[model samples]
Target: MSINIINRSGHPLPAYQTAHAAGMDVYAHLPAEPVTLGPLQRALIPTGLFLEIPEGYEAQVRPRSGLAYRHGIGIVNSPGTIDADYRGELKVLLVNLSDTDFVVQDGERIAQLVVARHERVAWQAAEELSETQRGAGGYGSTGTK
Candidate 1:
């Protein structure tokens, strides 16, 4: 699947560092000094990127596990969906989950972008669904007690 993308930022295009990686590292586009996020602070970090996604697909903005583990930084809306028709610049909603300040620098790999194919469902208007052995069980019902 070839996607048409326009990168307006100073950094290079997002790419996967290794083979078989599920997502590409998305960079932070900051022209000036780094932005500081205090404890529990949230900010929208722009990527200056626009995409022409094909129909029946979506781009998901997800948190970088390394950042989340090292600095306690993560995307507020992890796996944020970018619909196929959305043409605006890509921005990530980042949150500082740690007690200390987290600095967001230019060209920082703040998040990951995963392009995936999804299906559109049509409701059958049925009042009943097939039951299973653990039907209607939710939350921790299937987990170890």
Candidate 2:
């Protein structure tokens, strides 16, 4: 499925690097000055891009593994959803989890955008939910070594 996009960043459009890559890398559309994030600081970085996702589909913003692993940088709300009806600029909520400062540069790869199809569920209220062998078991109920 093709998506309609408006890119005002003057940078290349987000594209998948590999054939089977599920997400496309998104870049930062910052000004000349670099933005600094102190330890445990968070910032909303813009992409200067607007997308028109098709109905029944959504765009998800996720953190890049390299940034999270090497610089301790990640999206505060990983897998943030961009509704199909939203028509605003795409922004990333980035947070620095390290003790040092991190700099954000213009056109820098900040996050990944994954477009996925989702289903809507209707309420089917029932008196009681069915029971199972592991019913009501949650939060490490399965156990770990």
Residue 90 alpha-carbon offset, candidate 2, angstroms = 0.2
What are the runs in model 1 whose C-alpha is more than 4 Å off? none
Supply the TM-score for candidate 2: 0.96
User: Candidate 2 residues 79-144, lDDT tens each?
Assistant: 899999999999999999999999999999999999999999999989999999789988998785
Q: Write the per-residue lDDT of candidate 1 for residues 56-93, one digit (tens) a residue.
A: 99999999999999999988888899999999999999
Question: For each candidate, C-alpha RMSD in Å?
Answer: 0.9, 1.1
Worst ten in a row by lDDT for model 2: 136-145
TM-score of each: 0.96, 0.96
Against the reference, the lDDT scores of all candidates come to 0.93, 0.95
